[model samples]
Target: MTTQEFWNKVKSPEYKVTQPRLAFADVLVQNQDVMLSAESLYEKTKTIFPKTNLSTIYRNLESLERLNMIYKVTTDDGLNLYKLKCASNEHHHHIICTKCGKVLDIHFCPFDTFSELAGKAGFTITEHRLELYGLCEDCRK
Candidate 1:
């Protein structure tokens, strides 16, 4: 979506558009492959908007989340991370590292096969989140 369109979505739900919010969205929209924790995003956005604070980042994240423009991801470490939800993409899962908190994306929903198995077993599955925790290669080294 164009920046204008994205901001329009943000505006639709009584959300205020500000430089900090715009910058925060830009980071997620641009570096989409990397799911970032609040602290990581705040640290990077600060270079462009030096006055940006952690509180502001958190607020902007909440606003985006309210609009469903982004999704909240909780790492095993109990840290909250955010990823942009693009309408063009389908549902997916994430693979995150235990040692370094790195996140990797799985483009398709990982539960379809499990759904089949559960059906065979006469078990109904409504929702699920599969988080595999382990050391990433770099961390393992």
Candidate 2:
């Protein structure tokens, strides 16, 4: 999402747009293709606004996540990464590059196949997440 669009979603009665929050959002908007750990995000945001703290960054990240303006995924090593939600309004999943942390949107969903299997087994699927991890072309080289 663009910086303006990010701000538009953040402009609500519940959330106040402070400088630190704006800086955090800007960093995410500028790095849409990257998935960053909270620590890495805090460092980048600090570069833009020196007064920001890690706690503030965490709060903003959690709040934005609840607002559906950001996406979060945990790495195999248990590191939580965050990325700005893509501009597409359609339901989608993500494929991440393990070597470079590049995130690509996957428009194709395997939910229907899974759902059919669940129905046969007398089960219902409530929620699901599909994440694929591998090296991107540049990272593979």
Candidate 3:
């Protein structure tokens, strides 16, 4: 979404839209398709707001995640990366590049047919998350 579009949503009563939060959102919106670690985000945010703190960045990220404005993906190497949620509200998973930390969204859900199996096992499945990992094209070269 454009910065204006993002601000329009942020203006809702559900979000506070503080300066730090707005700066964080700007960075994410600018790099919408890229998955960034907290440190990476903090570094970029500092460029936008020189006084920004690492803890504040983390707090903003957590708040955005809680608000469903962003999602986190843990890489195979155990690094937590985050990106803006898809503009569409569809359910999807991500395929991450372990070598370069790139992310690609996959629109299909693996559990589409598992409900019957879950019922047979006397278990009810509520939600699930799947992250596929491998080298991206550039990383493979």
Best by lDDT: 2
Question: CA shift at 98, candidate 1, in angstroms?
Answer: 5.3
lDDT of each: 0.74, 0.88, 0.82
Instruction: Decide which is better by lDDT, 1 or 3.
Output: 3
- Residue by residue across 1-141, what tens digits does model 3's lDDT show? 987877776565656767877788889998887788999999999999888999998888877777777878876679888888778789888887776667788989888679879989998999888888788899999
**Per-candidate total of colliding backbone pairs:** 0, 0, 0
The lDDT of model 2 is 0.88
47 in model 3: Cα distance from truth in Å? 2.0
TM-score of candidate 2 versus the correct structure, residues matched by position = 0.92
- Give me the candidate number with maximum TM-score: 2
Error of 1 at 45 (Å): 1.4
TM-scores, each model vs. reference: 0.72, 0.92, 0.84
Residue by residue across 1-141, what tens digits does model 2's lDDT show? 788888887787667877888888889998898989989999999999999999988988888888888888898799999998888889888899987789888899989988999999999999898899988999988
Model 1, 1-141: lDDT tens per residue? 566667766676467767887777677766565567889889888877888999988888887787888866676568887767644665667776766656676777768899999999999998886655666789899
User: What lDDT score is found at residue 8 in candidate 1?
Assistant: 67
